[model samples]
Target: MTTTTTLEPVRGPFVWRGDQLSGTDEWIFRLSGDQIAELEDAGRRFVADDPDLRFVTAAEYPLPVCADAVRVFGADLDSGRGFVLIRGLRMDGYDDTLAAAIFYLLALHLGEPMRQNLLGDVLDHIVGVSDKKYLEGGLPSRTRDKLPFHSDSSDAVALMCLRPPASGGLSSLVSGATVYNEVLARRPDLAPLLLEPWHYDWRRQDPNAPADTYTSPIVSWTQGTFSMYAGGDMIESAHRYPGVPPLTAARKELLALVEEITYEPGVALDMDFQPGDIQWLLNYAALHSRTAFVNGPDRAHQRHLLRVWLRRDVDRPLVPRFGKHVVVAAPDARQVGPGDDTGRFRIADAATIRERWGD
Candidate 1:
């Protein structure tokens, strides 16, 4: 972890307030009819072969018509707004497998998909299996609790809506650069602290992970490029482990202030996800969260989203300490659990997550 002493204010398109975007729908990219048709054709062809998703390439599942759309989405992530919402996939026609195939195929065009769990699941299902809070031992994505704004462990993240929750469950994003600028404006003292290394619990990432805790600065600035990796919940939890340093009062204040600014008026951009909507976010550029949600009575009608983490082919670089969880490359080829398990393609329930990767 090379030390960066400068705490200069960040600039560029990534530093944008949500208020300025309210009058516009520019952040959203509605798929044209041709794009949807190309995707459906590609999805059906790929699924028919029963190909391993981990090894699939954009070339194998070509998106000739939507290639330009893919490039713009990728550009928005790395250079422009740091997020994009793509609407217009008609969910009624897609079965679970076809939906997964289309989502995975789109992800391949933007970046290389990475495993999200010990099961080497390149695609993961985000569904609430229990009502417990993450702090109360439930997996964050597997619970109905409200998640605080935080960065995921990846260069880019994509979530395709399979079913929106019956009520609530609004998705929100705050620009990491915007948050940083605001923090600097308010508390110049605390801004510098964000550039210092902080401990994060690694155990929650995977049961088979090699380490217990990892260290990284909340924000990284290298040669005028700005990026951030933050999860205050994980940082606080890491302190519970032996040998990890405890957070000082100043550090705690800094974390709390950061969260406070995220919720300030005109700061966070919130979205109501519809079925077939896909959201692409550059993790380092934005911190994302979800409101608590309700579900239908049965499993089939419940809220579900397919999520994939990707390592994009972008020029942005960060501090060396940033990646303890994000996989920059695909791991060695491996099989999922026993033959009965389908957790790799889609995690149907929390029991499968726990059984495949211990909590």
Candidate 2:
């Protein structure tokens, strides 16, 4: 679906680089000791009622302190700066299940969780599973591979650290606004091209999904609000479909410029994660990536994170193409799953995750 109305050039004000972002703690929230206690107590009660619980259920009983933070965080994710980090959760004695429960609990207040894959997974385990079989083609989340700068299929994407890798796995985040600003400065002709729609691969889609591909643009703006939906990996893979329009020379150049800008020093902020750290990025305004990680000789030291993709009650205005880019959660949907299945995400241990899916 394309718009026929001629739109003017968009030059938004949120554009910014790492030098301007990394120096400030305005985006960081360090939990106080009282808040930590509040969370631990909440987890105890939650697990008692249901040891294996999802966020939707845990959210029934709220932590007053966390409730306040989630309110402000929701605002920031949409308007202010577009990213926030929650710190100081003591991870020393917590189990993966409990930590995930707490993380998911906080996320419920931010927005409803979206299914992360066609398997109908609501909660995602960001750990490399033994299955590398799907990586040859599909957008499988279980891998040690590096992720290109991209956004997820939701209004906001979140991850909570469970284990720190022995090496690598640092997160690199770049602002779409910053990249757009740079493009406007260097190649004004490319600015408008970014507004045009391009098809994306449906690798993460289940066999039961409505389509094998979807269309969207890298940047979208309404009035003064700016939104972006880019997944370099997915865009490149879309070309495999003969019907999808190929990237023209100018489009290719724009893609290359995005890659270069995301990697250039001082442009993207690279963060080394701690076990208790939780990161949330506004999908529209931020693009993030991760380096390939290595596990220590001891399997216990392997890296892992819990991931959640959310759709807020309040979200930015989107281009017509956005319908294909984001998956909206149903109000009565009790469990998070794909359009075709009843799947429950189960965390087996700190090192492994188990989910029910029929391949």
lDDT: which candidate is best? 1
**Tens digit per residue, CA lDDT, model 1, 183-226:** 78877877888888898888866555567787889988886789
Cα TM-score per model:
0.90, 0.87
lDDT measured at residue 97 in model 1 versus the true structure, 0 to 100: 75
- Candidate 2 worst ten-residue window by lDDT: 1-10
Mark the regions of model 2 whose C-alpha exceeds 4 Å error after superposition.
Answer: 1-13, 51-59, 130-135, 138-140, 203-208, 323-326, 329-342, 345-352, 355-359
Candidate 2 lDDT by residue in tens digits, 1-359: 12234444334434667877788877788998988988888866655555333344434767787778777777778777788889999898788767876786777767777766655666777765544544464234566677788887777889999887779988888888888778777777677877878878774454555676888877887766788888776787778776777778887887898888888889888778888899988888888888878777775678888888877757467777663443563662325444344345443332247532321
Question: What value of lDDT does candidate 1 attain over all alpha carbons?
Answer: 0.79
Model 1 CA deviation exceeding 4 Å by range:
1-6, 298-301, 325-359
**Model 2 local distance difference test score:** 0.72
Output the lDDT of residue 228, model 2. Answer: 82
